[model samples]
Every structure is written in structure tokens, then in C-alpha cells.
Target: MLEVEQKFLLADKTALLDQLAQLGATQETDQEQEDLYFTHPVRNFAETDEAFRIRRIGSENRVTYKGPKRNTVSKIRKEIELAFESGQSAFEQLTEMLELLGFHPLRSVRKRRTPFTCQHQQRAFEITIDEVEGLGLFAEIELLAEESELQEADNAIIELAAYLGMTHPIRTSYLGMLIEKETQSGSD
Candidate 1:
């Protein structure tokens, strides 16, 4: 499926939460997520604009494959995700298998995310408040759509972000931002 998502840096988390409440958004899941990213040994995923991430949230584990962004304005991409109930053990096994098969582990990202959802004019949208470790607060509004419905989803995301008082738009991923910050500071 196509994952149509937009992210912005949140200056005030409380203010956004208040806005979401005013908009009648209901809290969905509040969880901490740890993601481990890997690179193919023979291919450069960064150059190819692809990502392979293994994520653990609470007692569940998932592996996600994200294709390149389809547009310049929004983070619309092709994504496939699989969930398993085996938790951390499965995650470790997967990591070991990937390493053994030549996939290189990159880095791990940790974040506490609380997701909220509301319906506008019968269409549903998800708003996630993310407190990423070392990355600060971010708000993301996302919807899944077909390739043909991307414009509609993008328009909706823009409207929702504006309503929530997001003045600065951030299209970069947390991983990219963190890497850039570290690189600029000359720290690993």
C-alpha cells in the first residue's frame, strides 16, 4: 500500500495536544518504539532512497520496508509492514539473520509516540505526536491511499496541519536529521 505521510517539527507539544482535543481527536496508542535500521551489504539503500527497519513496540514486533518518496512535497511512499507476536526474541533473531546474510546494521532510533485519530467530513486521518530521543518533538499526519489518491491525501494533510497551527514544515526523516546533526557537530 501507499503510505501518505507528512511530518512537521512541533514547537509546543501541549499546544498541539490541545488543538487535537478541540478537533475531537481520540487518543489511539501511546507507546515507545525502538527501530533498528539496516543496509544491504551489496547495495546502498541511502543512495537508492529505500529503508529496511525492524521495529519493536511494547510486546509486538514489526518489520517495515519503505520505498523512496514519490513526491517532493509529501512523504508518499510504497510501504510493506509485517507484524509478529514473538517480541524481542524474534527481533534478535531477525537481526542476527540479517547480519549473517551480509546486511549491515546502521543505527537505532528510539521514540515515544502517541497517536490520535479524528474524522473530518467522513474521512479519517491519524495524527502522531512523536518525542524522538535527541530529535525533539514532531507531529505527523498520515493516511494510507492508493497511488491515484495521493493528491487528495496530501491536500487533507496540509489542511489538517494548518488547522493545528504548524507554521514550519519538516519533510526530513528523524534518521536523516539526527545524522546531519551528528555530522555537523563532528560527533559519532
Candidate 2:
């Protein structure tokens, strides 16, 4: 699947909160997301850029690999099912691989909110973090899934962003940030 997401840097949380309430977009769930970013060698040990996701949004261990489409994913689903049956989740396998690669683990966390979905889904807000706190942070608001949809998710979110006084878009993915920090810290 093609994952297209937009993120923004919120300058005012209080204003955003009020706008969200006015739009009836209540916070769905807030939790700390922790994870480890590591590098490994797969395939020919020369080509693949292997990485491990050691933790996730709370304890919800959902490993999602975004492949193009059906046929490829169908085979993956089978393999994943087998892994679960063997009592070895994908994360467990990944953890083992990372250990073998001589990569030390780096852990981090950030608070995130899972957005609530409703009919037409005219408004939605999802804030997530892989490492909790002021660092490795990001926020998102998705609106209007299809062009034909009557309600616009963006209008509400944009209004909230303005109300919150958003100034810039945070382009760095938390995973990427954590990797940089972990490697830098490791070198030090």
C-alpha cells in the first residue's frame, strides 16, 4: 500500500485542543510509543537495507510492511501466520536478527493519540510518537479519504492548525530521528 501522510509542527496545544473540541473531534487514545531502530544485513548481505522495529505504540505489536499490492502481501500474510503459530512474533525474529548484526539497541518514547473515526470521517486527528516526550515528536490530521466525499477532513484540521498557530511542517520521521540520535549517542 502507498502510505501518504502529512505532519505538522504544532505551536499551541491549548488552542488546538479547544478547536478540536469545537469540531467534536475528541481524543481517541493517548499512549506512549517506544521502539528500537537497528540496522542489519539481509538477502545477499550486501543489498538489502535491513532494520528492526523493537517496540511500538504501547504494546500493540503490529508489524506493517508496505509492499505494492495483493500477490506479494498474500504470501507475506501466510508467513506471518506461520510465525505467530510457532509462538515467534515478527518482532521476536527481528530482535534476534539485530542482535546478530552487532547493533546495540537504542530505545525511545513519545506520547501519541489515536484518532476516532466516524461516518464520512469529516474530521480526524492522529498524533503519534515512537519515543515519548518533547523529542522525536510529530502530529497529523487526515481528511477526505476520497475526492468524491462530501465532507472535508482538511478544512477542520487546517482550522485547528491555524487556531493552534502551527508554523511549520515537521518532515523528519521519528524513526529516522531516533536512528540518528542512537547512532550519534553510540559514537559518543
Candidate 3:
């Protein structure tokens, strides 16, 4: 399925949360998650966009391949699983498979998600409620679907920002930004 998701960087969590309460946004679940994304084992994948990931959050272990949709994606995956271990082992081996497919690994990011309880919302824009860890109650509005909907999604985000009295609208991907911070701190 085509996915459209965007992250809104909020400054005042408490204030916006209070506004959310006033707006009738109900609390749902309070689950935390720690995510770790890895690259496919294919050496050439270092330059491609395909990603083979191993997500370890709470007690769940899921291995996912976020690569371009290929005709034999499922068939190839079944062959790989039957030939190797599951979870991390399978993820590691995916890199090798990508190599055989003439694809290369590209970017890898690890983000810890702590998503708060978010019931369904009735807003003016299209939103995909992200139940992640570390970040609570994320509003992801993907603009990748109808390229034209980009402006509409942006406007909706702006409205949400105003309604919730939010600030610090971050543009960088959280996973990449967090990793960069950690690296900078370590080097310093």
C-alpha cells in the first residue's frame, strides 16, 4: 500500500496536550517502543534506497523489508525465510539477497518511539495516527499520494499547530536528527 505520513514537531507537549483534551481528544494507550532499523546486507545497497529492518520494541521483534515493490518480492522473501533464520538473522541475510538482485543498501536509522494513547480524531486534514514510542501522539499526514495534496496536508498541519498552540515545527527526520545529535555529542 502507498503510505503517506508526516511528523509534527511540537514544542510545548503539556500545553498542546491540554488543548487536545479541550478539543475532546481522548486518551487511548500508553505503550513505549524502541526501534532499531538496519540496512540490507547487500554491499551495493549502500547507495540504494531499499531498506531491510529489524524492529525491536517492547517485546515485539519484527523484520521488515521496505524496498520497492517487485513482482517476486513475496516469493523471494519466502525462499529466504525457508533458507535462513527469522527476525534479526533473516534481516541480516536480506542484504545478501538484495545484492543478488543487483540492489544496494542505503540509509539506516534507529528511532525510539513512545507513542501516547490517541483515540480517533475529527480534524480538517487527513491524519494517520502513529502509535510509536518515545514520541507521544504523533500526527502523520503523508503528502506523497496525490502530489497535489501536499499543500492541503501542509495547511492541515498548520491548523493543527494553531489549534494545539504548538511550536518548534521540525523538518528533519527524527531518526536521522537523533542519530546526528548522538554522534556529535560523542565526538565532542
Candidate 4:
């Protein structure tokens, strides 16, 4: 599936929440997520614009692979994710297996996320308000769609974002922003 998403830095969480409520959006269970990103032994994922990460939410673990961005306006990419057994031991084993195969841990991104579901233009969009550790707050509007539905999905995301008064969309991933921040800090 393709992940058609637009992210924005949020200035006021309460205002956004009020807008969502007006749209009849329903809240989902909030979650604390830590994503451990990895580097391939032989390839540079950053240069290739790809990402491989293991995300841990409570006891559940999921491994996701995100392909390069397909568009310049939004974060349109191919994403494949698989869930593993839910436990510390299982998570460790999976990490060990990846390490054994030559994948090296890069960094971890932690965030508290609250998600809402709303229907717009006949599509269900997953909107997440994230409080990213060290990176401030962000809101993402995303829709998962088939390859053939890319344009429609992108349009829906854009329209919804505008409707919510989100003017500028940030295309940078949270991981990328964190890395850049760390680099700048180190240089300072």
C-alpha cells in the first residue's frame, strides 16, 4: 500500500482538537511509540530515501519498511509493515536477528501520539497529533491507498489540511528532523 500523508508543525493543539471535533472525528486510544531505526549493512537508507524501523508500542512490535518519497508535495511512499509477537523477549529476539544479519541500530524516536479518524471526500483519513520527544508537536493527515488511488488520496489529504487551517505542510519526517537537530547541536 501507499501512504499518502501530509505533516504540519502544530502551534496550538487545542484549536486543532476543536476543529477535529467539528468535523465529527472520533478519537482513538492514545499511544506512546518508540521507533528504532536501522541502517543496512551495505546501503545508505538516508541517501536512498528509504527507512527501515522497528516500532514498539507497549508490548506490541512492528517492523516497517518505507520506500522513497514519490511526490514533492507530500510524503507519498510505499510502506510495508509486519507485526511480530508481543513481548520483550520477542522484541529482543527480533532485534538480535536483525543485528545478526548485519543491520545496525541508527537512532530511536519516541513520541506520544493521539489519533483521530474522520471521513472526507468519501475517504477515511487517519489524523495524528504527535508530541515528539525533543522535536515539539506535529499533526499528520494520512490515507492508505492502492497505487491507482494515489492522486485521489493526495487530493483528499490536501483538501482536509486546508479545511483545518493548516497552511504549510512539512514534508520532512520526524526522524530526519531529529537527525538534523542533533547535527546542528553537535556543530554548535
Candidate 5:
């Protein structure tokens, strides 16, 4: 599936939350996600602009692979995700297996996310407000679109962002921002 989304740094958290509420968007689920990123032993994911991540949310876990962004304005990418009902022990075993198969652990990103869903132009969009550990607050508006619905999705994202009074959307991923920060500070 394709994950098409636009991200923004939230200047006022409470005001945005209130705005979403006024827009009649209901909170669907709140989650704390710990994402463990990996790279192939012989390949650099950073250089390739791809990602392989194992995410643990509560007792549920999933592995996701995200292809490189297809465009510069929004995060339009191909994604494959699989979920398992196993607990932490099974997650650990899977991690070990991936390690044995030559995937090296790169970093872990932690965040608290609350997702709200609303309909616009007969299409549903999910807006996720994230409080990333060590990174502060951000908001993301996402619509799952097919290859043919790309333009429609883009328009809807822009309309929604404008409706919410969001300007200056960011194109950088949290991982990239963190990496740049580390580079500037000269520490891992």
C-alpha cells in the first residue's frame, strides 16, 4: 500500500487539539510506539533512503518496510506492513532471527501518538499528533491512496491542512531530523 502524508511541526498543541475537536474528528487510538530500525549488513539504508523497522506497540508488534519517498512535497511512498499477535518474547526471537540473517540494528525511535480520523470530500483522512521522545511535538495528516488517486489525495491533504490553519509543513522524517541533530552535536 502507499502511505501518503504531510507532516507539520505544531506550534500550539492545545489549540490544534481543540481545532480538531471542533472539526468533529474523534480520537481513534492512542499509542506509544517503539520503533527499532535496521539496515542490511552490506547495504546502507540511509544512502538508499529506505527503511526496515520492527515496531512494538503495547503487546502487539509489526514489521514495516518503507520505500523511498516518491515526491519532494509529501511523503508519498510504498509500504509493506505485517502484524503479529505475539508478545515481547516472540518479538525478541524475531529480532534475533533478523540479526542472524544479517540485518543490523541501527537506532530506536520512541513516540507517543494520538490519531484522529475525519472525512473530507467523502474521503477519510487520519491525523496523527505525535510527541516524539527528544524531538518535541508534530502533526501529520495522512491518506492511504492508490496509484491512481495520488492527485486527489494531495489536494485533500492541502485542504485539510489549510482547514486546520497549518502552514509551513515539513518534509523531513523524524529519523532524519534526529540524525542531523546528532551530526551537528558530534555525538551519537
Candidate 6:
């Protein structure tokens, strides 16, 4: 599936929440997520603009692969995710298996996320407000679509973002921002 998404750095959390409420969006349970990114043994994922990560939410574990962005506008990419067994033991086994195969853990991004969902123009969009550790707050509007529905999905995301008064959509991924920050800190 194609993941069409736009992210913004939130300047005012309350205002965004109020706008969401005005749109009749329903908020879902808050979740704490830890995504551990990995580096391939022979290839550079950063240069390739790809990502491989294992995300742990509570006892559930998911491995996700995000391909390069297909366009310059939004984060339109192909994503494939698979779920593993639910437990610490399963999580460890998966980690060990990856390590044995030469994948090295790069870093972990921790965030507290609250998700909201609403329908716009007969299409459903999932919006998330994330407070990333070390990085500030961000809001993302996302829609999963098939190849044929890319244009419609992109339009819906742009319209919803404008409705929320969110300008200057950030194209950088959370992992990329974290890495940039680390690079700057180390240089200083």
C-alpha cells in the first residue's frame, strides 16, 4: 500500500486539538511507541532514502519497511509492515535474528502519540499528534491508499492540513530529524 502523509511541527497544541474537535474527529487512546531503526550491513539506508525499523508498542512488535519518497511534495511512499508474536521473548528473538543476519541497530525514537480519525470528502484520514522525545511536538495527517487513489489521497491530506491551519509541512522523518540534531550537537 502507499502511505500518503504530511507532517507539521505544531506551534500550539490546544489550538490544533480545538480544530480537530471542530471537524468532529474522534480521538483514540494515547500510545507510547519505541521505534528502533536499523542499518543494513552492506547498504546505506539514509542514502537510499529507505527505512527498516522494529516498532514496539506495549507487548506487540511490528517490523516495517518504508521505501523512498515517490514525490517531492508529500511523504508518498510504499510501506510494508509485518506483525510478529506478541511478547518480550518474541521481540528479543526477532532482534537477535536480525543482528545475526548483520543488521545493526542505529537508534531508537520514542514518542507518545494520540491519534484522531475523521472522514473528509467521504475518505477517512488518520491524524496523529506525537510528542517525540528530544524533538518537540508534531502532527501528522495520513491516508493509506492504493496506487490508483494517490491523487485523491494527496488532495484530501492537503485540504485537511489547510483546514487545521497547518502551514509549512515538514517532509523530514522523525528519525532524520533526530539524526540531524545529533550531528549538530556532536559538531558543536
The lDDT for every candidate, in the order shown, is 0.86, 0.44, 0.44, 0.93, 0.88, 0.93
Q: What lDDT is obtained when candidate 3 is compared to the true structure?
A: 0.44
lDDT (C-alpha) at residue 12 in model 2: 49
The list of candidate 1 runs beyond 4 A from truth reads none
Error of 1 at 69 (Å): 0.5
Candidate 2 error regions (>4 Å): 42-54, 66-94, 97-131, 134-137, 143-164, 179-188
Per-residue CA lDDT of model 2 for 1-188, tens digit only, reads 12223466554465556655665665666665555554334332112323344455554554333222112111111111111222236556766766787755544444555454322233444432222354533456443334333224334545544554664544444555655777798999
- Model 1 steric clash pairs: none
* 1-188: candidate 4 lDDT, tens digit per residue: 88999999999999999999999999999999999999999999999999999999988999999999985577899999999999889888888999999999899999999999998778899999999999999999999999898888888888899999997999888999999999999999
Candidate 5 ranges with C-alpha deviation above 4 Å:
none
The better candidate by TM-score, 1 or 3, is: 1
Name the TM-score of candidate 6.
0.98
TM of each candidate vs. truth: 0.95, 0.54, 0.52, 0.98, 0.95, 0.98
Model with the higher lDDT, candidate 3 or 5: 5
Tens digit of lDDT per residue, candidate 6, span 154-182?
98899889989986899999999999999
| CA RMSD per model (angstroms) | 1.4, 7.9, 8.7, 0.8, 1.5, 0.8
Q: In candidate 1, what are the lDDT values of residues 55-170, reduced to their tens digit?
A: 99987899999998866577888999999666778889999999999998898999999999888756689889999999898999899998788888888887787888875677
User: In candidate 4, what residue range of length 10 has the lowest lDDT sum?
Assistant: 69-78
